[model samples]
Target: MTALLLALASSIAYGAADFLGGFAARGAHVLRVVMVAAPVSLAVELLLWPVIGASFDGGAVAWGAASGVASAAAFALLYKTLAIGPMSVLSPVTALVSAALPVAVGLASGDSLSALAVAGIVLALVAVVVVSGGDAGGVRPSREALVLAFGAGAAIALQLICLDQAPHGSGVAPLIVGRTVSSLIVLTAAFALGAARLGATRPDTRTAAGAGALDSLANFSFLIAARHGDLSIVAVITALYPAATVLLARVLLGERIGRVQLAGLGVAAVAVSLLALG
Candidate 1:
């Protein structure tokens, strides 16, 4: 129960962070937004490290670094695809692909789920697709966008798997290592590509910072959740983040929600209930 709650909280935080990041990216270079956000996230992880108290060997750090690389690649590809594709199409595809890989890994590794839990997972997957909508504006994704979206999803799956490789009871040290590696990679890439400019204005920087903080929190929650729960279940719940993002848009940005979205939301609630009962 605690693990499920943590995973749900992580999804919500991730959705909010992505919303803020998307808003910031509109006014600044995507690389710049990432570069700025990474450092802020890293700082937060550093602050939490001593309090959490980690115990791990070099193998954990290696796994964490690998996860960071995967994470950086995932974000870069996702942002690139979002720039060129109808988000309605790209978002659902990426979310589904990301969740599918983890579930496959879990099942293949002999992790057994209850019948109710399996049903919940199936519904959760369906909810991601329905909630994401489908070419609402009738814009088709370019071939390049579709390819990038798949790549991003694969990278996300790799990131989650690698994070799970960290030794048990390592506190947040693995996250700290992962964040540091990702931050440095993104920063270096941004500089090499001439995308290191912070922002055209201070507000952009602040917005990026807020996104960074929330993203850090989300990652922390996910790491803790993964430590306590099965990877398949945790990944599915976390992938439900888009629902939270969409809800926020409706409430805060006054974005209109269609019947499909509402149905998806209802289905998502049912899925959660089934999982809890299981």
Candidate 2:
């Protein structure tokens, strides 16, 4: 129960962070957003380090760094895809792919769940697709956008699986290392490619910082939850983040909630209940 709750919390944080990131990216280059956000995330992780208590393991650090690199690729591609494609198509595809990969890994690793839990996982996956407004009208996605979305989704799944490889009780040390690695990579690329001018408006900088802090919190929550629960289940629940993001859009941006999305929310509630019962 505690683990499920943590996973849900992570989903919420992830959704909020992504929302902020999307907003920031609209005003600045995606690479610039990543470059600024990574350092802020790193700072937050560092601040939490002493309180969280850390274990310095070389293997864990290596896994975290690998996850970071994957994450950097995922975000860059995701942002790029969103900029060019109809989100209705890309969002659901990405979410489904991300959820499916972890489930595959967990099953292969011999993690077993009850029949009820399995049903919940299936329903959760469906909910992610429906809640993304996949049926909504939008321009057809280009081939490039589809390719980028798939790549981003695969990278995200890899990031989650890799993060789970960290040894138990490593706390947020892996996250710190991951953030450091990702930050440097993005910063270096941004300058080397001259993709974006470093001079961002104050508002954009603040938005980037907020997104980074929330993203760091989401990572922390997921790491803790993964330690306490089956990776398959945790990943599915976390992948439901688009639900929160959609809800936030409706409430804050006055975006209309489609009937499909409402139905998805109801289904997601039932799915969570089933998982908890299992």
Top candidate (lDDT) = 2
Q: Look at candidate 1 and tell me the lDDT of residue 228.
A: 89
- Candidate 1 yields a Cα-based lDDT of 0.79
Candidate-wise lDDT, in order: 0.79, 0.81
RMSD versus native structure for model 1 = 2.4
The window of 10 residues in a row where model 2 has the poorest summed lDDT is 194-203
Give the C-alpha miss distance for residue 236 in model 1, angstroms. Answer: 0.4
User: What tens-digit string does per-residue lDDT give for candidate 2 at 1-278?
Assistant: 98899999998997787767766777457887787788999999999998998776997799989989987887687766654545545666677788899989988998889999999999999898778664444346788978987897898899889888888778887898888888888988888876336445323888778878998999899899999999999999988887766666557655556788788888899989989998
**Clash count, candidate 2:** 0
Clashes of each: 0, 0
Off by over 4 Å in 2: 84-89, 134-141, 195-203
Q: Score every model by TM-score.
A: 0.91, 0.92
C-alpha RMSD for every candidate = 2.4, 2.2
Worst 10 residues of 1 by lDDT: 194-203
